[model samples]
Each structure stands twice: as structure tokens, then as C-alpha cells.
Target: MTEMSVQLEQIAVRAARGVGDALRAAFVQAQQPSHKRDHHDLVTEHDERTEQVLRAELLDAWPDSAVLGEEGGASGDGAVHWLVDPIDGTANFALGLPFFAVSIGAVANDQLVAGVVYDVMRDTAFSANLHGAYADGEPLRSTGPATDAQNMLITSYPGPGTLAAGRGVEEYTTLLREFGAVRRMGSTALALAYVAAGAGCAYAYGIHPWDVAAGALIVQQAGGRYLPLPDTGRPWEAPGYLAVNGDFDLPGSCLTDLLPRMLPRTATGTPLPGGGLRNRP
Candidate 1:
């Protein structure tokens, strides 16, 4: 399993970087992206093309593997299942923001064994296998201040889906007050990667399997906490995620109040002391 995971990790890294040149070239030009769910959700030609490129590479590299990609959908039925989001921040990329990424993860035995989150613009890869997490091969650890007031929290919560569910500015405002600062950078994969690379808290609701699979593994491998919201047995089976810096000291944050209301299931686990919960699940 260890050797297989290492091989998969390498395959993910190579596949993610292989399409970089084309993506970078496309990034410079002004291109329009069609909307997916709404104006807030976008899908560009590059996104589709990149996913195709990644899918072909992954399947070719591991013939006995299946791929669940955001753009192209699922293919094959092997033991090692791959989750991929070719362009994680498509809206950001379309709008000329340098925050998108190529994310891929390998799941075997009902567990994440390998993963990679490639920051395309920066050409950086945060990878993890059974051994540990690394940023371009260096050991990486996700740690930050213990108190909310001492660190910066990054989130894209209250997205269109969340807003429709009644989690709007109030929850956002509350998190801002409790945390030293709150930022909405708009990329779940990269945001999770950032958290694993020693950034602050990151959470999201209404995410697909491809969106959080790789980043979740990266966070956990880098010594951070990647909690599937509502405590689903499998993180990808659920629609939400709550990721905290490795040394953030506690299990919950100011965002705790929003989770229960955001998802269909009630949140259950250890109680959150500092996390003010108005809508306790």
C-alpha cells in the first residue's frame, strides 16, 4: 500500500504539472467562461480541456484506476479511484485572478492514500502520500496561532448554495468578529492547501467530491485537521468541509454556528467552547 501510494502521488504530481504550460498560456489571454450553476459559478474552455488532459494522463499512468473528474465526469472502475478538479478556481482564473489550481487525489481501501494540489500560476505543488506531506518535496506542516483572534481565517462560505439555504452575511459577519480577520479567496482546493501550509481556518459547504478530495488529504497529511462537516463517514460523501490549521488547538471555530444550518444533518461531536453556536445542531 505504501509503495502504491507513493507511485500514485508521483503520478498525481506529474499529471497536474504536465498541463501547466497550456493553462498558463490560456491564463494570459482574455477569455470568457460560461456559467454553471449561476453567475457565481463558472466553466471555461480551458477548464474542460485541462480536465481532459489530466484525465488521459491519470488513466494512462494507472490503467487499473478510475477517475472522477469535475469537467469530464467519471471513467473506469478500478480499485484506485481518482478525484480531480482541473481548475479549482475557474471564476478566479477567468477574472484574471492568480488563484486557481489543478487538484487530484487517490482513494483506495476507502481512504485517501495520495494527493496533490498544484498552484498553477505559482507552479508549486503540495503533495502527500503515505509517508508525509511536502511542498515541492520539502516537509510541510500546517500550524498557526491557537486563538481565533490571533490568526487569519479564510473562507468562501455563504456561497450561492449556502445563501439559498439561509446562511448569509450574518454568519460571515460573526466569523469576522471572532477571528482576527476573514478572507474569501474563492478556491476550496487552494484554500485547503493554504491551511495545510500553515494558513488559518478554511471551511466550505455545497462542495463536490472533486473539489475537496485532494485538498482534504493534503491538510490531514500536513498535520492539520480536515473534518468532514456533519461528520460523514466519508468526506466526499458529504457536501461540506471544515479544515483548521494543525496547531489551531481546538476542533471548532466561529463558523461552527453555520455548519448545522448549512447541511441537512445535525452536527455531532465534542462541543465547541469558544465557537458561539446560535443554531446548535
Candidate 2:
């Protein structure tokens, strides 16, 4: 890893940790979440406040960088871009669930160089740089069962929009019948963090850049596979993704057969129309 990449990784980790206290205090408390695009999409004061905190920390650490946040839009214009998801899984967070996380990833000259996903409830940080990936400062390896039936898969597939699209239900059924077990924990960042930590594989559709930018880099750096479905110029910019452990057999897994049917294709690189719980983050 270059010295600059390592420095960026440290900055990302610290920036994510900076908001832990406020998030912990707000979690499970009575929060009046206002709708963003719809009832399924939610945002709270904490989300906005945390984004501000993260934006300040990141820009302060690297003054020549820009920030693209979920709550707040783009800020600054520099070679380095920071993708920030202040509070991933806001629904779970407001309801007292402990599956949310703070995710930040840095892109230098259009390439993802560093990322950090901090699990506030667990107090565990999953990070990665050009050098390698780490979990709580320890080296992380994305090793798991080799076969689909032997490994656990995490995904929030077949969300409201997907169902409305008329193909998600069948896809969801196939996953249930193929994988050993399937879980929907409502947090894409944490789900990908688990994949990086060797917990399992994760798949999702209809997500935004901030949703997978950090987790995707962490997973790949951990020696896992982070494949952006229907490449949209850049990996982090993809609308959907399928991440697996380092040892997963993608060609043999059912996912390979299902990808074409599940993800929408367009003549242009624009993302297909779909929506899900993870769409907010």
C-alpha cells in the first residue's frame, strides 16, 4: 500500500468512529423519523447531524477532498472524493435494533483506495486500504464454505420495488431454496462487513453508491469477491452488487444463474429502476 492510501484508511476509520457516541445515545430512543421518498425510507435528525460531523472530520483531515453523503449532497470539489453513509439501517436503528453502521469510503482519482465500516452497537470497525483489510485492527480474511448450500448468504432482495417489478419474488424463492440459510438484517453496510469478516456472502439490488462503497472495498481487500452487477463504469457506482467470501464458488453458486434475471439491463449505463429498504443508505 502506498503511504497515502494507509493515511486515507486511518482517516476513514477515525471519521466513522467520531460519531459513535451520538449514534449510540440516539439508538433505541424515541425518534420521530421523517419520510424521505416514501414511508419505507426514513431519516432522522441524527442522520443529518452525523453526516455533518463526518463531513467536517473528513474535510478537516484532508482539506483537498470532496464529500458525497447520503443525508447531505455533494460538497467541495477535489481529486479525492469521500462517500459517506452516516447512519446505515436507520429503520433498524430507530426501532432499537443493533444492525446499523457508519460507513465511509474514499475514492482517489476515481479509484476506491480506502474504506471503513464502523458497527456502532458492536464497537467493531472493519476497514481496508490498498494494503489489506482489517477487523478491529486485526487482519481479516473472507474465508467461508466453498459451496452455496454449505454457506450462509445475507441479502435484502425482493424489496418493495423489486416485487413491483414482477421478478423479485421468484428470485427470492430461489435463494431460499438454494442457500443453506438466508438472512435479511436490514443493513447493507454491516452485511458486507460480515462478508469481509468471513461471516457470509451478501447480495443486494437497488442500492446507491454510499450504500456499498465502503463495504465493497473492505470485502475485496479482505480477499473476498465484490462484484458489481451490470457494471456502470465504476464498481462503487453500480446500482446493485453480489459480494462473496474469498472461498465462495461463484460459477457454481445459484447466483450466477440468477444474476441476469435479477438485475435490469439498460442500453445506457444508467441504473435500472428498483427500490428496497437499503435504498435510503
Candidate 3:
């Protein structure tokens, strides 16, 4: 990795850890979560606070950088673009479930250079840069069971949104029946982190850039496969993704059959125009 990429990785990790303590303290506290789009979508005071903290830390560390945060929207107008998901699994965090994370990914000139996914409950950080991927400072290797029948799969597919869109329910059902086991963890970042750590394969439909940007880089750097389904021109901007340990068999799995049906028709389905990267000023 170049020195600049390493520096970006360190910054991302530091920025994420800046608010870890507060999130830990608030994890179990009673929270009144307001709906974002519907009952299935939720946001809390902690989410907003955490995003604010992350935004301040990132911009302070690298003044010439922009942040695209899930809760706070876009800020700054610099060369490096940071995608932030302060509290990925708000419902899980609010309900006392220990399965959420702080995800931050840095894009320099349209290329993902660094990423960090901090698992607040476990106090473990998964990070990646141009150099490589690591979990708690240990190099990660995405090795796992080779077959769908032998591997575990984590996904939150066919949620209310997917069902409402009238897509992928039957395919998801087939996956549940075929895979060794399937789990819905709610946190997209953690799911990809786990895959990087050689835990299991993960697939998701209808995800945002903030949700998978960091995790996607981590997966690739760890020697795993992270594909934005339907091959949107920019991988991070895709509406859905399929990620797996390096050994998982994509062609043999049920996912191969489901891919065509899962992806949206257009190449730029979600329309993140001019959002890939920026020129350094």
C-alpha cells in the first residue's frame, strides 16, 4: 500500500473509534426510535449523535475531504470522499442486540482506498486499505466452506422493502432451504466483516453506499469476493450486493440462479451521479 492509503486507513479507524465508547454506553439504554421511512426503518438519538461525532472527527483529521453519511447526508467538498454509517443496525442496537457497527470507507479519486468497520459490542475493528485487510491487527484470509450446502449464509434479503418491490422472496426461500444455514443479522456492515473474517457468505438486496462501502473494500482486501450484483458501473453505488468467502462456490450456489431476478434493469439503477470520486484541490 502507498503511504497515503495507509494514512487514510488509520484515519478511518481512528474516526470510527472516536465514538465507540459512547455507543457502547448507549447500547442498552432505553431509546425511542423514530421511523425513517416505515416501521421497519428506524433511527435514534444515538445514531444522529454518532454521525455528528464521526463527521467532526473525520473532517478535523482531514480538512480537505467530503463525508457522505447515512444519517447526516453529505458534507464538505474535497478530494477524498468518506462514506459513513455511524450506526448500521439501529434496531438491533436500540433493542439491546449486540450486532451493530460503525462503518467508514474512503474513496480517493474514485477508487476505494481505505475502510474500517468497528463492531461496537465486540470491541473488534475490521479494516482494509490498498495494502491488505485486518481484524484487530491480524491479517485476514477469506477462506471458508466451498459449497452452499456446507457453508453458512448471512443475509437480510426479502425484508419489507424487497417484499414490497415484489422481488426475490421465492429465491430467498430457496436459499433458506438449500444453504447449510441462513441468518438475518440486520447489520450489513457486520455481515460483510464476518465474511472477511472467514465466518460466512453474505448477500443483500437494496443496500446503500454507506451501508456496504467499507465492508466491500474489507472483503476484497481479505482475499474474498465482493461483487455488486448486475455490475453497476460503480460497485459501491449498486442497490444490492453478493459477497462471499474466497472459497464459496458462486456458480454452484442458488445465488447464481437468483442474480438475474435480484438485480434492477438499468446499469445506473439508483443514480449516484458524479459521486464516484473527486479531483484533489
Candidate 4:
């Protein structure tokens, strides 16, 4: 790996780890979340506070960097752009569920070079660079069952955006019947991290850069497939994604027919009315 890639990965980890303690303390402490888009899309004070801290830390560590955060829009302008989701699963965190995480990714030269996804309550760090993906510093290999009939599928589909596009339910129904199992995990970042750790084939819809940038690098580094929906040649910027486990046969799976068809046209129409990624019209 280049020295820059390794350095960026360390910087991301430090910035994410720096905020773990504060997140743990406020995990289930009567957080009153307000609607961002709706009740389905929520944000807490902790989310803003954490993002501020992270953005500061990241920029301070690498002065030649910018940040595009979930809570805060693009700030600073440099070669290294940092994508951050201080609280990836805000709904889960506000509801006293232990599934939220901190996600940070470094994009330089329009390519993802380094990233980290920290599971706050669990204290596990999933990270990646040009070299490979790692969970708490151990190498990862995203192997799983080859076919959908025998493998698990994880997603947050049928979301407000998916439903708005009028395509998710029928496709979801097909997934429900074809996959061996299905899980609707609130955190897209963690779902991708899980896929990198050999958990299951997963998909996410209408995600911002902050949501999947880190997880994308981690999944791809772990010997998995990161398919950017709409396939605009820029996985980091694309709003939709699918992360399949290493051994999974994506072409043989049901997803090949459903999501790829729905995304290109649907993503442009997916609503992001309140407090979504800026300049996404």
C-alpha cells in the first residue's frame, strides 16, 4: 500500500475512535430525535455534535482535506475529501437500540483510499485501505453461500425513497421468497461492514456519500463486490449500492434483476425533502 493510503486510514480510525466514548454515554439517555424528512428519517443533537467533532479532528489531522458529513454539508476544499456519518443509525440509537456506528472515509483523486466504520456500543472497528479490509486490525475475507436460495440478505429497502419510487415492494416480495433469510437492519454502514465480514449479501438505496463511502472501501477490500447502482463510474457518489459477499454469485442471484433495474431511474426521483444531502436535486 502507498504510504498515503495507510496514513489516511490511521487518521480516519483516530477521528472515529475519538468520539466513541461520548456516543456510548448518550446511547439510550432519553434522546429526543426530531424529524429530518419524517419520523422515518430522524436526527439527534448527538449526531450534529459528533459530526462537528469528527470534522474538526479529521481536518486538523489532514489539513489538506474536506468533509461531506451527514449532519454538516461539504466544508473545506482539498484533494482529500472525507465522507463522514457520525451516527449511521440515528433511529436505532435514539430508540435505545445498540446498532449505531461512526463512519469515515477518505477519498482522494476521486477514489476511496481509506475508511473506517466503528460500531460504538460494540467497540469494533471495521476499516480498510488499499492493502485490505480489517475488523479490529485482523484481516477480513467476505465469503458466504454462493446462491440466494441458501444465503441471507440484509437491507433497509422499502424505505421512504424506495416506496416513493414505486418499485421496492414487489421486488422486496420477490426477495422475501427467494432468499433463505432477510433482515432489515437500520444501519447501512454496518450492513456493509457485516457483508465485509462474511455476513450476507446486502443492498442499500438512496444513500449519501456519508452513508456508504467507508463501507464501500471496506467491503471491496475484503474481497467482496461493491456495485454502485446506476453505475455512474463513481461508486462513492452514486446514491444506491449493493454489497455482495465474496463467494456469492451476484449474476445468479435475484438482485441482478430487481435493484439494478429500479435504481437508475428511481434514485433521481427518490425524495430527500428535508435535511438530506445538499445539492442533490
C-alpha positional error of residue 23 in candidate 1 after TM-score superposition, expressed in Å: 0.8
Please report how far candidate 2 places residue 35 from its true position, in Å. Answer: 0.4
* lDDT per residue (tens digit) for residues 118-187 in model 4: 9999999999999999999999899888998888898877777657767678888899999999998899
Q: lDDT per residue, candidate 1, 1-281, as tens digits?
A: 99999999999999999999999999999988998878888999999998888888998999999999998889988999999999999998999999999999899999899999999999999999988999999998997887778878777766665567665667677777888888989798999999999888887767898888888888998999888764556876566777888888453555555555544334445332224443434
Alpha-carbon deviation at 17 in model 2, angstroms? 1.1
Judged by lDDT relative to the true structure, which candidate is superior, 1 or 4?
Answer: 4
Question: How do the residues 1-281 of candidate 2 rate in per-residue lDDT, one tens digit apiece?
Answer: 36788999999999888789889988858989999999989999999999999999999999989999999999988888999999999998877788899999999877889999999999999999999999989999999888879988898877776677676788778889999999999999999999998776898878888999999999999999887765655889877888889998776788766766666544123443222212322
Query: What TM-score does structure 1 among the candidates reach?
Result: 0.90
Model 4 scores worst on lDDT over the 10 consecutive residues at 272-281
Runs in model 4 deviating more than 4 A are 161-167, 264-281
lDDT of each: 0.84, 0.86, 0.85, 0.86
Comparing 1 with 2 on lDDT, the higher-scoring candidate is 2
Over the stretch 1-281, how does candidate 3's per-residue lDDT look in tens digits? 36778899999999888888999989868889999888889999999989999999999898989999999899999998999999999999988899999999998878888999999989999999899999987899999988888988898766765577787678888888899999999999999999998876988877899999999999999999888764665678877787899988666777665655555445334432223311111
Q: Model 2: runs farther than 4 Å from truth?
A: 265-281
TM-score of 2: 0.92
lDDT of 3 at 34: 94
Error of 3 at 162 (Å): 3.8
TM-scores of the candidates are 0.90, 0.92, 0.91, 0.90
Candidate 1: misplaced stretches above 4 Å?
A: 161-167, 256-281
lDDT of 1: 0.84
